[model samples]
Target: MAGGRIVVGVDGSAPSLKALKWAAGQAALTGDSLETVISWEYPASWATLMPGVPPEFDPERLAKQILKQAVDQALTPEVAATVTRTVVGGNAAQALIDQAKGASLLVVGDRGYSGFKAAVLGSVSSHVAQHAPCPVVVVRGETGDDEDA
Candidate 1:
């Protein structure tokens, strides 16, 4: 899909940064526009567990900052400038799935959780892979490497 949009989920994790890098490279090769997305939600029990949230504690703002930093770190200035950043409020997997509605590709990171933890909590990449409207790429491994696979 030439000149299509590539949607990628970034959460400031090492793996997500790697995914962002991979998505940017793919966009470069495909002549597609890159759109980086991040999502945030308040804990289910936040109102009961911590009744008084700080007035200045804004999860959405924090998410936006993380998204911006991830894109800046993962791509060059010229490329970063061309990228579209999106911040959404809701479940991460669902957010990506919704954002990827007509996208050429959806990319996310495999956080590499193992065994019991993975089975217990599941994962965003795993969920999106099964549910995204478009093809998905789950980037896995160390984050800082520049090698291409």
Candidate 2:
């Protein structure tokens, strides 16, 4: 057994789905527990940009739903049975790192659902890759536009 478990970050992105799938397979093969996590935070900038944002529309709830869907989509029923889902409020990278303390592996997508067109690695992936306590895998999305960007 590798230390504790395998931690994976999901943000409802295609790359995230791939990461989750990869993690699930690894966990099953290695007999390590799987922790599927999604992190959410109401950015301070968003408050100023959209002051009328409804409080009833909880971002955490949405993040939880997305996590659940991503896990369901990525892992088969048998594989998913071994997963433990989690939702936390904080920076995505930090949430993943915190939960990955003694994990054997930390997996994340190359980029999330961000609309930014400039960078190859998103902030979360870059942060987690640089800071994760364990080995990290950054799953590449199949989008052909990555090189052109």
Candidate 3:
């Protein structure tokens, strides 16, 4: 996979941070450039759930911050500097899948949804694993790197 790209999704979750670290390591081993992606979407019921959003509140900026912080926390300064960060305004799975086009690998994390919940509410990792343009690796557990993740 020399000269190729490895796309990974970061959502500020413990498992997602783990996936970022794993993806960075894999990218280093395979000589692939790393691209870290995050996505944001206003809830469908935003008007009812939360009537007002502060004018200064920016979801995209927050998403970028999360992605950058995750990469910074998970990878060394040298490796983090080499990463390409992307923040999309849509579903996380679709964003990763779209970013992974022509990539050698797509990496994501599993939140361990199972049984009824998993069946009822499909997970991003599972959806991307089934639909991504390249091979998908779902990191299944936390890295313990960020207690706050």
Candidate 4:
């Protein structure tokens, strides 16, 4: 939401890694702050009832751990120094859309590990492109020569 800030959605997949790299480069070129958002949702069972266990589980902390791991895997030291991380809960698309409200641009991977059809873009990418408040860029993943041809 701050000035010259770009929001990127990351999920630790190859495509998302590529997106993060591209976003880092773009941020450097444009002097913008890159904000990486990792959204997660707990299982229904965890949310509804814990049975015998305490129900004080911190979903936000778990989400932060996931986000940190993903970011660590994707970013180099140079890139990591300039980026801010945000961990949130809920659907990836909706979380990203909400974050995009005051962003200069929204960046995402064209495909993730969601196991959707090869013929279609990942659902989160498609949803963000359709509904995000700022301009969206979907960075396509690298494909093998066989697939490219």
Candidate 5:
């Protein structure tokens, strides 16, 4: 196994699924523990303001659900067994950066939900690549080598 922890950010996107697979393979090869993180924000509500609204809503449960579903759909049973999941609030880029502080490598998808229609990389992925403490890998969609030529 590898000597350091491998952390991957997953957001249920196709690129994220690819990144998860890649991270799993790396973890398996290096014998490093894998930490799968999924960050979520509560949906904004336009309903009448309640007098007793909580300071911060717990998106952890929702993040967990999404992460679990993504993992179940993307990985084989054996590969999925090796991952550990975490959920946090705030921006996805910041969350991944925080997680990267203790990790050997951070993996993310090239594009996710936070992208303009013609964007090459998602905002979070681009930000994390520029600022993460650990090495970052951005998984891109699979395409023939000649496609970009």
Candidate 6:
């Protein structure tokens, strides 16, 4: 967390991309720096079955790649240029909460890449909304009735 920062959680989902666009628009207007965070976790179950960490398996690198891809997809070149990328190995909610402690706001999608698509709020977004130190914005897509699904 840092002063004058706005944090947004991204997972490459459509909602997340929409959220990123929304957040970027806000950042441009408010002059606050945007930090795009994408969290990841390697399953603990893999530890028991694997002899050693694979040379080809780099979770952090993969996380950054995902973050980069999401940013490229969601934002215009001007918007994406001003953003700072953060990749962490842990729970997305907790990471977002911590990142928001010194932020002006926390923005997330209505849902993410996970099961329970019908749920109004995905687990990560729900947790961040309830616990973030700053005010939270959950961006949902669709500008009008016909566009909503």
lDDT of 1 by residue, 1-149 (tens): 58799999998877888889999999999999999999998877767766788878998999899888888888999999999999999988899999999999999888732223546343888899999999999988554775652
Off by over 4 Å in 6: 1-3, 47-55, 115-121, 142-149
lDDT score for residue 3 of model 6: 37
| Alpha carbon lDDT of each predicted model | 0.86, 0.84, 0.83, 0.81, 0.82, 0.84
Identify the superior model by TM-score, candidate 3 or candidate 6.
Answer: 3
Show model 5 residue runs off by greater than 4 Å: 43-59, 115-121, 143-149
Q: 38-106 in candidate 5: lDDT tens per residue? A: 887643541343445575744577678889998998889887876788888877889999988979899
RMSD of each: 3.8, 3.3, 4.3, 4.3, 4.9, 3.9
Q: Please report the candidate that would top lDDT against the real structure.
A: 1
lDDT string for model 2 (1-149, tens) is: 75469999999988789888888878768888899999998776887866888878898889988988887887888877778999999878899999989889999988887534376457888899899999999877777767522
Tens digit of per-residue lDDT, candidate 3, span 63-102:
8888888888888999988899999998777888899999
**How much does candidate 2 score in TM-score?**
0.86
Alpha carbon deviation, residue 66, candidate 6 (Å): 1.0
TM-score for each predicted model, relative to the true structure:
0.86, 0.86, 0.86, 0.78, 0.79, 0.83
The TM-score obtained by model 5 is 0.79
Query: Residue 140 deviation, candidate 5, in Å?
Result: 0.8
Best by TM-score: 2
What's the lDDT for residue 15 in model 6? 86
Model 4 weakest lDDT span, ten residues long: 46-55
Sort by lDDT, best first: what order?
Answer: 1, 2, 6, 3, 5, 4
TM-score of 6: 0.83
Pairs in steric clash, model 1: none
Q: 70 in model 2: Cα distance from truth in Å?
A: 0.8
